[model samples]
Target: MGETPWDKGYASPPLGEFLTKWGVTGRVLVPGCGTGHDVRLLAGKGADVVGMDIAQSAIFRAEAFPAVSRECYVLSDFLDLAASYRATFDWVVEHTCLCALDPSERSAYVDSVCAALKPKASFLAIFFREVSDYSGTGPPHPISREEIDLLFGPHFECVQSFIPTQTYPSRPVGSEEVCWMRML
Candidate 1:
C-alpha cells in the first residue's frame, strides 16, 4: 500500500477538537499513529501519550518531531503488542487506523484495542461510513455502524455514537461515525 498523505499533517480537526473539549488526560495509546500528530496533541493536553506504528520510518519521523520528544513512540504492530502493554492505557484513540485495515483484520484490531485498555477505559473512534461508489479497494476500507457495534459491543458499552458535523475535507459531511465506548 502507498504511504498515506495523512502521514504528514497535524491531527484531524474533529479529533483535535474532541480531545480538547473532553479534556482527556492520563495515559493514552494511539495505534497506527502515522507520524505522531495525535500523540503530540494528546501530550500537549497533559495526557501521557504513546504513539505506536508498525512502520519503522514512521517511528523515525515521529521521533524527530520536537513536540513529541517527551512522549513515547514505538515501532510495533498493534495486533502483536507486547504482553506488558496489556491493560495499560486509560484511553485508546482511533482515528484513521480502523479504516486502514482490511475488513478481515478488524476482529484482531478490536481484540488488540481491548487488551491494551484498562477496565472501563474509554475507546474513542471515528469510522467512515460507506459512500455509494466505494469499491472496497483501499487502505481505507469503508465501515458501517453495524459493523462497528458488532465488533466492539462484546467488550465495550457504547457511551455515545453519532455522525459528526465536522470532518476532514476529503470526506463527506455525514460520512463519519464518531463513537465513544467504555470497556466492559
Candidate 2:
C-alpha cells in the first residue's frame, strides 16, 4: 500500500476531549489502530495500551513510531481475536474500525469487543456518521446513532453521546458522534 488513507497522523480530537473528563485506568485495547496515534495518546494518559490491527504492515508502521512507555502494537484480527486477548482490557477505544467494516459484520465486531473488554469496562468510540456515497460502497459505511445503539445494546449501556466539538477540519459538519458506553 502506498499510504494508509485512514492514518490521521494525530489522535482523534474527540478522544482527547473525552479523556480530559474521564480518568484513564487499567488496560486499553485499540482495535484496528492504524499507525497507533490513539494508542500513543492513551498511553500518554498513563494506561497500558495495545494497538491491534489485522495488517502486519500497519503494525510494522505503528511499531516504528516511538513508544510511550506502556504502549505496544500487535497484528491481530478483531473479528477473530486471539484467545489471550479475551477479557484482558479495562477499556476498548474505537476510531475508524466500525465504519470500515461491512454493516453485516457489525454484530461480530460487537461480539469481539464484548469478549475483549473486562466486565464493567468502558467502550468509547468516535463514529463516522456521515458519508459522501449514499449509494453505499466503502470501507467507510457510515453508521447511524440508532444502529450504533442497536448493535451494541446487548453488551453495553450508553453513558452519553454527543456531537463532538473537536473534529478533523476536513470533515463536514456533524460528521461524527462520540459515544461513551459501559459494558453490562
Task: Provide TM-scores for the models.
Answer: 0.92, 0.95
Residue 160, model 1: lDDT of 77
Query: How much is the lDDT of residue 62 in candidate 2?
Result: 91
- Model 2 Cα lDDT, one tens digit per residue, 1-184: 2466667689998888888888767899999998889999999989999999998988998999988889999888999989999999999999998888899999999999999999899999989999776578887889987898788887888897888888777666588888899998
lDDT of each: 0.83, 0.88
When summed lDDT is taken over every stretch of 10 residues in candidate 1, the lowest stretch is 1-10
lDDT of 1 by residue, 1-184 (tens): 2566665476766676575557667899999998888889888878899899999998998889896435799988998879888999999999888888888999999999999998899999877776547887886787877887799989999887777766667677777777889999
Residue pairs whose backbone atoms clash in candidate 1: none
Query: In angstroms, how far off is 90's CA in candidate 1?
Result: 0.4
